[model samples]
Target chain A: MERKSIAIDMDEVLADTIKALIEEVNARTDLGIKEALLDGNKIRHFMPEHEGVLDEVLREPGFFKNLEVIQDAQEVVEKLSEHYDIYIATAAMDVPTSFHEKYEWLRTHFPFLDSQQFVFCGRKNIVKADYLIDDNPRQLERFTGKSLMYTAAHNIHNEDFERVNNWKEVEKYFLGNEEI
Target chain B: MERKSIAIDMDEVLADTIKALIEEVNARTDLGIKEALLDGNKIRHFMPEHEGVLDEVLREPGFFKNLEVIQDAQEVVEKLSEHYDIYIATAAMDVPTSFHEKYEWLRTHFPFLDSQQFVFCGRKNIVKADYLIDDNPRQLERFTGKSLMYTAAHNIHNEDFERVNNWKEVEKYFLGNEEI
Candidate 1:
């Protein structure tokens, strides 16, 4: 059987990048902003005072280096790779050092993932694939293929992906079996 | 090996009871609530006119007669039952008709689930089991056992259940390397 292809979003999909960034920025010099106000996925809300925080936090030693993989992502991807051409199609900004660090971390943790398959694009809606695994609701609706929303641990905004809480369902949907 | 006992929550965990309730109430003759304002776990800030609508909705046929199951729950539960003693532990108000109807609906859909194991209680936090699968974060925190939060498709409040998501992780935590 011809292997199916799966494209996964980067931020909040594979890694808890947003949470890490929020923690790193807040842990450092306080931006003097209310944490509750900056609770959700509105990245630019904290960017004003915590300028350069996103870049610095993502590049911090053991930031991306020590990122915890999404629950069951490693297992699901490994199993899916057995039957699918897996690709990391992300709507990530072109922050070279920070983005490269994420890729390196993914390579280290998910060694089965091909480094070349990681496509760092500004908009994932443009990409065409057999299946797309993303956390963004807007992006999910745009895809014609089977899509699994990667709901990050702290993301309370993308309620649409609530059904796709774990990688097991994604595995079941894409791979057609839950045992893997 | 002694089989592990698994506790399943009823509301958003097993059936789409909340959604059905909203739809039922909205379709009523008097209450003219245009949209359902379902919040993170609790349905707060509903139209004042819909106060009694909540009660009336519970009496509707579709609300009690044909509640939908959460995606992939039946499959996961059936497979899990192969290695576990599955029990339905739900927190239900003593609405006689609604209660009986829900029980009947559950029995009808997931026939593999032993009706004898179903226990409807006032508070799920007080329930005891080896494993508890629930969507409510409060229930998860209260239950000391290995609990897996049954995440909804648009939960938006997913961060709370980051530690546990899929049944595989729940199985791994409870059953270890025993072949399932």
Candidate 2:
């Protein structure tokens, strides 16, 4: 039988994109938006007062290239790679400019994965795998396989899918051992 | 029931990539390679003494951005979109630098497709669709859905899958109408 595969999202699940957004927005506009301020919605929802500020920052050339690798993401995913084929699927079509930078960032941080294991797309559901670990529920729309929701500030309230708060939990969920 | 979806490849299938490569290689290296010179072989296969010429050309930043669109591709795919959801899946992972350029090329040529319909990956089989239309047999490896091998100079000898010579033929294979 073919080994089961896992498709992991890039933004919040593996990369600390929200933290980078929060930092960049605060630097540009003095929005002073904290992790708590994000609450149950995305940074966009809080930007009604500062219209397009988030987009403006996100559009900067090197934004995604500088995002911090989420804690334990590289190590846990490396461990997970031993048992399941791992594909890093990112919705890059939304930000056309982010393509090359996102790829370079992955190469720098997750060097263990074959370059072939990377997938950049818009509709996450189109990625066929045994399991999908994503922070966005909408990205999982109509996916036939199991969906695991990676905890993000904006996605904390979403209860429709199985939730794993961090990479430690992800390790335990897949490998039954969080000690790694 | 959801409408059946078709995932089409970007390179030789929809974009006149090999033709562009031949033109560029001939201009730069004075190889004078022509359509007939490429008889059932890729431009790279003929470059025994000129190794890395193809790689250097492909690595150029604007190479993918300036490719010509295959004849009748846009109109036929537009008609096919009416019956099946359409996704343009490209193996951009092989050429990390080609990612953004390929996306912009599609946007400029196939304006009817939404940004979300684009998928860039290394393994084409990861894309879930009712049908995958591609020029490379390796890209169709292990696919569960029906596969159509779009004809290219190098892939002409390949008969592992159903073949369609051009966009008009592709229309007939899927839509049963080549009139467009």
Q: Quantify all predictions' global Cα lDDT against the true fold.
A: 0.64, 0.88
Q: Evaluate candidate 2 and give its CAPRI docking class based on DockQ.
A: high
CAPRI rating of model 1: incorrect
DockQ of each: 0.01, 0.89
lDDT of 2 by residue, B1-180 (tens): 778999999999889898888887887897789876677887778889888888888999899999999999999999999999999988888789898789889989999999999999988768888899988888776666999888888887887999888888988887787355
Off by over 4 Å in 2: A178-180, B178-180
Q: What would the per-residue lDDT of candidate 1 be over residues B102-171, giving only the tens digit for each residue? A: 6667768889975556654434433446777887777778675776777553354667654444555555
Model 1 clashing residue pairs (backbone): A153-B159, A156-B156, A159-B154, A162-B152, A162-B153, A162-B154, A163-B152, A163-B153
What are the per-residue Cα lDDT tens digits for candidate 2 across A32-114? 88987677888888768888887788789999999999999999999999999999999988888899899999999999999
What's model 1's lDDT at A70? Answer: 72
lDDT per residue as tens, model 1, A20-104: 6667776876564443565454665656766677667765666766667777788888888888777776553444334446656
Alpha carbon deviation, residue B56, candidate 1 (Å)? 76
Listing every candidate in turn, what is its Cα RMSD in Å to the true structure after a full C-alpha superposition? 20.4, 1.5
